[model samples]
Target chain A: MHDMMIPFGPAHPALPEPVHLKLFLEGEEVKDVDFSVGYNHKGIERTLEEMDFSKSIFMTGRICGICSSAHSTCFTQGIEKLLDVEIPQKAKIIRTIVFELERLTSHLLWLGMLGHEIGFDTLFMLCFREREYVLDSLELITGKRIVHDINIIGGVRRDIPPEMIKKVNKNLGILKDKVDYLQTLIKKDPLIKKRTVGIGNIDKDDVEKLCLVGPVARASGVPYDIRRTDKYLIYDDLNFKIVTQKDGDSFARAIVRVQEMFESIRLTRQALTLIKPGLIRNKPAMTFTEKEAISRVEAPRGELIYYIRSNTTNKPARVKIRTPTYANLMCLNKVLVGNNLADVPVSLASLDPCLCCTDRVTVVREGKEEIIKLEDLHGHH
Target chain B: MFHAIVDCVGDGLIVDKIKKYCLKKSPWIFHFCTGGCNGCDIEILAAMSPKYDFERFGCLVKGSPRHADIFLITGPVNKKIKSRLVNLYNQIPEPKVVIAMGSCALSTGIFQKAYNVCGPLDKIIPVDVYIPGCPPKPEAIIDGIVKGIEVLAKKVK
Candidate 1:
C-alpha cells in the first residue's frame, strides 16, 4: 500500500486545462482512480443568467472554441424553437454545411493530437499539413475559419459563393484521398495498433447508464449519433452513414473520427449542390416572447445541447449548455480503471474531452473539510 | 567609406544567420478571437499539434504578466472574458508581438453589434500581425509567427 497518493494535475502538461487525477497505484497498474475537474470554470451558466437573449449567443460560443459553431448554432436554434419560427430550407442546408465543416476541423485536430500522444510525430505533421486545406477552404467560404458566426437565429449570415464551391470540390477530392490513405495507415501501422488497441474499453451496457455520445458511444457500438437519430439542420436531406466500431477501444475512437471526415466531405458536397439562392437573414425579433427552448446539434465530439429561456427581453433569463465533453468525462472513471498508467493520456484524449465546455465543479478533501465552489468557480484561478 | 561598412557586415551573412536563428527561436504571437468566440482555440491546437510543430520555434501561449515574447490568445475576449484581458496583456513577458488569426479575433465581423460583446480583438490586446479570414490559414499563422520574429528583431538592440 502506498502511503501517499499523488495528484497528477489540476494543471499539467498532459492536459491543456486543469483536471486533477488522484491515482492509487501499486507499481504501474492503477488500483483505484479518482478524478476531479473545474479548474477552468468561468461561471458561464451563472453569467448567462444575467445576460439577455442575443447576448447568450456569444456567451454560449465561449463554452469551447473547437465546438463554438455548434454551440452558437444550438443556442440560436433553441431561440428559434422558443419563438416557434420555421427557418428557411436554404438556411437549414447552409447550417448543416457549416456544422459539418466545424466537425471536420475538430476531428482532424483530434487525429493529429492522438498521433502526437503516442509519439508518432510525423503522422501528426501529415495530419495538420492536410488540415490546412480545410482551414483555407473554410476561410474562403465563411470569411473566417473558427467561429464562423454563420448560423443566426432565423438563418445563416452569408450565402455560399461560387468560387468557394469550386474550392470546396477541389479540397473534397484531396481530403477523400488523404482520409483513405491515412485510414489504411492507421489500421496497419504497428505503432498506432500497439498503442491504441484495447487501451480504453468501456462496457457495452454501461454506455446507456453513463450517457455517452458522439464517437465515444458510437465507437462502443452504441450506434447513437445525434444527426442520424435526432436529425437537425439539413441532416435529413444529406445521406451519410454514422461511423462506428464494436471494439470500444482507443483505436476504434480514432477510426470513427477518420471515417467521419469522409462523411463530412460527402455531406458538404451534397449541401453545395442543394444550396439555393435565398435570404440569409430573417428579421430578428426586437423583443423576446419569454419562452424556453432546447436545441441540440451533432458537434464533432458528440451531441451538444443548449437550453435557453427568453424573458421577453433582449437578454436571456437563463442559458444552459451541456457540452459533449462534459457527458463523455463522466465515463472516464470506468475507462481509466485497470489500465496501465501509460494508457491514461490515450484514454482521456479518446473521449476528446473539451475542458473549456465543462462547468467548473470540484470537491476537494483536505483534513475532512470539503470545499465546493457552488456556481462561483469563475473568479478563482 | 561605404566599402568599409559592407566588409564589416560580412556580406549580409549576419542578417541571414540572424533571420535563420530568430525564425527558429523567438516566434512572438498574439491570439485574437475577433467576435468573442472560441473556435480559434481549437484551430490553434492544430499548430500546437505534434504535426503542425508550433514548438519547433520555442513558441508558447503564455498566460498573464505577458512573459510571452509573443501574444498567442484565443477568442475575441468576450465582455465576460474581457476583464481578464488586462491581466492577459499585463502578463505578457516584455518585447512582445501579437497575432490575430481568426476573423472573430479580427473585427467580430459576423457577430458585430450583438448584445454583450466588446467586439474586435484590437479593442484590447494591442495586435501586431492580423491574419484575416474566419479562422486564418495555418500557413498564415506560421507566416505571422515568422514575421513576428522579424518584428521583434528590428525593435531590439
Candidate 2:
C-alpha cells in the first residue's frame, strides 16, 4: 500500500482562515501531521512598533473581529495598568457586559460553524438566527455590532443608557429562552452527536500539555479558566459555573460551549443589575517616562493577552498580542493523528478553529513527503 | 435631487423594473479580504444574522468567483492575496460588481505602512462601490450590496 501526504491549508473551507496542515497518511488514517502557518502574516506585531500608544489602542482591535472588543479592552487595560490608573467601576461593569456579550456571540458563531462544517445547514441557520438577537442588542447599546469600539483608556467610551437597560433586559430574557431551546435541540439532535462525538478525541493529558484555553480546554476537563485564575473586571462579583466535559472530543467541546452560553446569559443578567453608574473612562496620564504593562482578558475563544510599552510618547514602543487561537493551534498536530479522512473535518471543527484569528500551523516534512494544504483539499474534494 | 435621479434614470422603465426586481431578489455577493484582519468577516456575518437579515433580499455569500455576482471584499488585500484577487476577479463572469468594505480594504487604514500590505483594493481590482468604516455597519454592508445589485443590473445593457 502506497502512502500519501496531504496538506490542509493556511486556507481551508473546514477552517475560516489559512492554517496549513501536512498529514502523512497510511491507508487513509493520519500517521503523522506537520503544521504550517504564516499565510496571513501582516506583520501585526511589527506594525505595532511604529504606532503611538494612543493610536495602538484602536489598532489592536483589528487583530480579529470576532474578538475585537476583547482586544480593545485588553489593550487599553494593559496601558491603563502601565499608567497606574484604576478604571472607573462603571467602566469595569460595562467591560464585563461587553465581554460576556462577545462570549455569547463567539460561542453561537462557533456552533453555527460547527453545524455547517458537518453539513447541517438547518442548524447553522437556526443558531445564527438566534445570534441576531445578540447582535441587535449589541448594536442598540454600542452603535456597532461586531467591533463595539466602546472600550477606551481609563474606561469605556459609552455608558449604558436608561432606555437601553430595559431593552437589554428584554433582549436577555428572549435570548435566554431561545438559547436554551437551541441548546436542547443541539444536545438531543442525533445527527450532531453522530458527527461530533469522539471525532477529534484530544485526551486529557494532551489537553493540559497543549495549554489550550477556553471551551476547548474545559471540554478536556482542565478547570483553568483565566476568568477564575486571573480575575479581571467584575468576574469576582458574578456567580457562574465553569462548563466542562470529560469526553475530550468535538462533541464534548460543543456541549461545553452550549452550556457556557447559559452561564453567559446568567452573567449578563447579573451585570445589568449589578452595574452602577460612574465615570465610564478616566483621563489618561498626559505623559509617561517609560512604562510597560500586560493585560489579559478572557475572550470567547480563550485568554487574550496584550502587552503594551510606552516610551514617553503618544505612540507605543511595543505592542504584543497573544490570541488564544495561537496556543490552540499548537494542539492540532497531536489531535489529528489516527483520525480517518472522513472524520478530519469534524475533528478540526472541534477546536472551532478560525485560522484568521487562530495560529497558522506550519508543517516541516522531509523527503518523500507530499504536502497537502487544507484549502487545496477542500477545493479538490 | 429629482433632476439628478431623472438624469440617471434615463427614461428606461424596462431597465428600471428589471433593476428593481434584481435588487429585491437574488443579490449575489463575493467576499474579498484584502488584508487578513477577520474583523470585517465577523461584521459581514453580523449582516447575515437574523437581526440584519441580508438573506431576506435573496443574498448569499458564494465561495467561487464564477458564482458570485457582487463582491463583498473585506480586509486590506495584501501581497499574496493581491494577485489571487485579480485571478478571482477574472474568473467571475461578466456583469460583476465589487464593494470594498472595512478601513484596511479602503486606504489600508492602520496597516497602511506595513511592507507586506498591498494598500487599497482599488489598486488591483476595479471597485464599483465603497463602504468606508473601520468595519462598516451591517446595514451599511446591506446598503453596499443593494447598490451593487443596482450597478450590476445597469451593466447588463
Candidate 3:
C-alpha cells in the first residue's frame, strides 16, 4: 500500500490560524507528522531593538491579538524590573483585571472555534455572541475592543474611569450567567461529548516530556498555572483554584478552559473590587545603564515570558519572547500520530496553538531555515 | 441543423448572463489572514456573527477560494505566506474582488517596517476596497464587502 503525503495549512479552514503540517497517511490513519510555522512572523523582536523602551510596549501588544494584554504586561513588567520602578497598587489591580478579561475573550474565541471544528454551528455562534459582552467591557475600559494598548512602562496608560466601573460590573454579571450556561452545554451536550471525549488522549508523562504549559498541561493533571506559580501582579493576593482534569483528552481540555474562564471572571471581579484611586505609574529616569530583567505572565494560552536587556541608550539591546504555543507544538505532533484523519482538527485545536504568538521570525542562513529555540536566547553580554 | 445550433448559442449566452447577475447579487467571500495580528481575523468573524450577519446580503464566508467571488484579506502578508497568498488568489476565478480588511492589509499598519512582512495587499494583488483601522469594526467590514459587491458588478459587466 502506497502511503500518500498531504500538506495541511499555512491556509486551511480546519486549523483557522497559520501553520503548515505534512501528514503521512496509510489509508485513513495518520502515520507520521511534520510541521513548519512562521507564516505569521512579524519580526517583532527585531523591531523592538530599534525603538526606545516606551514605544515597544505597543509593538509587543500586537504580537497576538488574543493575548495582547499579556504581552504588554509581560514587557512592561520586564522593563519595570530593569528600571527598578514599582508601579502603583491600583495599576497592578487594573492590569490584572485586563489580563483576566483577555483570557475570558481568548477562551471564548477558542471554544467557539472548537465548536466550529466539531460541526456544532449553534455553539459556535452562541459562544461568539456571549463573547461580545466581554469585548464590550474591554472596549469600555481600554478604548479598543481587540488590541487594548493599556500598558505603559512602569505603569498603565489609562485608569478605569469611575463612570465606567458600574457599566463594567453590569456586563460581567450578564457574561457570568452566559458562561455558566456554556459550561453546562459543554458538559451535558451529547454531541460535544461524543465528538470530544476520548479523543487526543495523552498522559501527564508525555505532557511533561514535551514541556507543555497552561491549560493543556492542566488538562493532563499537571497543575502548572503560572499565576499561582509566578505570583506575578496581584495573583498571589487573590483566591482562585487551579482547575485541572485527569482524562487528558480534548473534552478534558475544553473542560479545563471552561473552568478557567469562570476563575478568570472571579479574578476580574476581585481585581475590580481591589481597584482604588491612586497613582497609576511611577516616573523613571530618562537614561538607561546596562541592566536586564525577565518577567512572566499567565497569558490566555499559557505561560508568556519576556526577557529584556537595557543598553546604555533608551532602546533595548535585546528582547526575547518564549510564548506558550511554541512549547505546545511538541504535543501537537505527538498526538497527531495514530489518530484517525477525521479527528485531526479537534485534536490540533485542543492544543489551542496560536502561530502568531509562536512564530516570531524564520531566519534563513546559507540556504537553510532555522528557528531560534527558547533556551538559546540570552540578555546582553 | 444550422438554425438549431444558432438557437442553442443564444440560449447559452442568456444562461451565462443570468449566472453573472447572480454572482453580483451574492458574492461569496474567502478570508485569508497571511500574518499580522489576529485582530482583523476576529473582526471578520464577528461581522459574520448573528449581530452583524453579512449573510443578510446573500454573501457567505466560503471555505474554498475556488468557490468565492470576493477575497477578504486581513493582516500584512508575512514573507513565508506571500507565495501561498498569491496561490490562493490565483485559485479563485476571475471577475472576483479583493478587499484589504485592515490597516495592516492596507499599509502593514504597525508592522510596516518589519523584516518578515511582504504586504499591504495592494502591492501583491489588485485590491478593490481598503477598510482602514487597526482592525476595522464589524459594521465597516460589512460596508467593505458591500463595496466589494459593487466591484464585482463592474467586473461582470
Candidate 4:
C-alpha cells in the first residue's frame, strides 16, 4: 500500500490560529505525524533585552493576549524578587482576580472554538456570548478588556472599588449561571462525548515523557499544576483543588478545562470578598542590581515560566520566556497520529495549542541574516 | 482613483456599480495572524459575538482567502511568514481591502525592535485601514471593518 501525506494548516478552516502539521498516512491509517511552527514568531524575547525592567512588563503582557496577566505577573515577580520588595496583600489579591478572570475568558474562548471546530455553531455562540460577562467584569475592574496591564513590578496598577466589586460580583453571578448551563451541556451532551471521547489519546507515560503542562497534562492524570507546586502569588492562601481527569484523551482535556473554570470562579469570589483597600503598588527604585531571577505563573493554558537577568542599569541584561504552549507542542504531535483525517482538526484543537505564544523566539541579530540550505531544513520537522 | 482605475481596466460601468454595491453590503473577511501575541486575534473574534455581531452588516469571517473580500490581519508580519502573507494576498480577488487589525500591524506595536519581524504590514502589502491598540477593543475592530467596507466600496472594480 502506498502512503499519502496530508497537510493541515499554516492557515486552515478548523484552526483559528496558525500552525503547520504534516501527517503521513497509509491509506487513511496514520503512520506518523510531523508539525513545525515558526509562523507566529515575533522575537519578543530579543526585544525585551533593550527595554527597562518596568517597561518590559507591558511588553510581556502582550506575549500572549489570552494570558497577559500571567506574563506580566511572572515578569514583575521576577523583577520584584531582584529588587527585594514585597507588595501589599491587596496587590496579590488583585493580581489573583485578574489572573483567574483571564483563565475564565481563555477557557470560555477555547470551549467556543472547540464547538466551532466540530461544526457545532450553537455552542460557539453560547460560549462567546457568555464570555462577554467576564470581559465586562474585567473592564470594570482593570479598565481594559483584553490586555489588562494591571500588574506592575512592585504591585498591581488598579484596585477594585467597593462599587466595582459589587458590579463584578453581579456580572460573575450572571456568568456563573450561564457557565453552569454550559458545563451541564458539556458533561452530559452525547454529541460532544461522541466527538471528543477517545480522540487524540495520549497515555500518562506519553504525557510525562513529553513534559506537557496545563490542562493537557492534568487531563492525563499528571497532577502537576504550577500554582500548587511553585505556590507563588496568593495561591498558598487560596482554596481550590487541582482538577485532573484520567482518560488522557480529548474529552479529558475538555473536562479538565471546564471544571477548572469553576475553581477559578470560586477563587475570584474568595479574592473579591477578602480584598480590602490599602495600597496597590509600592514604588520600587528604578535601579536594579546584577542578578538573575526566574518566575513561574500558571497561565490559562499551562505553566508559564519567565527568566530575567538584569544589570545595575534600568534595562534588563537578558530575557527568556518559556511559554506553556511551547512545552505542550510535543504532546500535540503524539496525539495527532492514528486519528482519522476527519478527526484531525478536532483532535488538534482539543489540545488548545496557542501557536502565537509558542514561537516568539527568533535570535538573529539585525542585518545579519543567517542563510540555511533549503534542502537541509527539510530534515528538521 | 477607484473610478479612474475601473475606467482604465474597463469593467463596464453597470457591472462595476453592481460590484461596488455588493462589496459594501457583504464584506466577507478572512482574518490572518502573521506574528506577535494572539490578543488582537481574540478581539477580532469577540467582535463576531452577539454584542457586536459584524455579520448583520454582511461581515462574515471566511476561512479561505478565495471567498474573502476583506483581509483582517492581526500581529506583526515577521520574516518567516512574509512569503505566505503575500501568497494569501495574491489569492484574494480584485477590489479587496486589507485591514491592519492591531498596534502590531499598524507599526509593529510592541515588537518594534524585534530582530525577526521585517516591519509593519504596510511595508509588505498595501494596507487600507489600521486599528491601533495593543489590541484594539471589539468596538474598534467593528468600526475598522465598517471602514474597510467603505474602503472596499471605493476601490476600483
Interface RMSD of each: 6.4, 3.6, 3.0, 1.7
Where does model 1 exceed 4 Å of error? A1-4, A360-381, B1-40, B48-157
> In order, what DockQ does each candidate have?
0.18, 0.31, 0.53, 0.62
Give a tens-digit lDDT track for model 2, residues A1-381. 339988775334565665567788999898888775555656677787787767776677777778878888888888778788888888888888888888899998888888888899777778888887888788887888777888777887788987898898898899899888988888899999888877788778887777888888999998878888788899898899998899988989998999999999899889888766677877877577688888888888888787778887767787767888788877877678888877787788778765555432334668787867545532331
Angstrom error of the Cα, residue A145, model 3: value is 0.4
lDDT of 4 by residue, A243-334 (tens): 99999989999989989989989999988999886998898887788999999989998998888898888988888889898888887667
Q: Report the backbone clash tally of model 3.
A: 0
* lDDT, each prediction: 0.72, 0.77, 0.86, 0.85
After superposing all C-alphas onto the true structure, candidate 4 shows an RMSD in angstroms of 4.2
Question: For candidate 3, lDDT tens digit of each residue in A1-381?
Answer: 338988888778886677888889999999998887767877889988988788888989988888999999999999888888888998899899899999999999999999999999899899889999999999988889999999987788888877788888899999999999999999999999988999898899998898899999999999998898889999999999999999999999999999999998899888888877889988788578899899998898899889889989999999999999988888876788888888899899989988888886434559666776532321101
| Candidate closer to the true structure by TM-score (higher is better), 1 or 4 | 4
After superposition on all CA atoms, how large is the RMSD of candidate 1? 7.2
Q: Which residue segments of model 4 deviate by more than 4 Å? A: A360-381, B1-18
Q: Is candidate 1 or candidate 4 better by lDDT?
A: 4
Query: What is the Å distance of residue A54 in model 4 from its true position?
Result: 1.1
The CA lDDT at A104 in model 4 is 99
**What TM-score goes with each of the models?**
0.77, 0.87, 0.93, 0.93
- Candidate 1 lDDT, A1-381, residue by residue in tens: 653466775424455544568888777777777766544444567666666666667667656767877888888888888877788888888788778877888888888778877878678777877887787777777777666667667887788867778888898788889888889999999999999998989867888899999899999899888888778887887888988889899999999999989989899989989866777777665567778888888888988887777786677777767888888988888888788888888788888987767744444556866555443444443
- Candidate 1 displacement at residue B67 in angstroms: 14
For candidate 4, the lDDT comes to 0.85
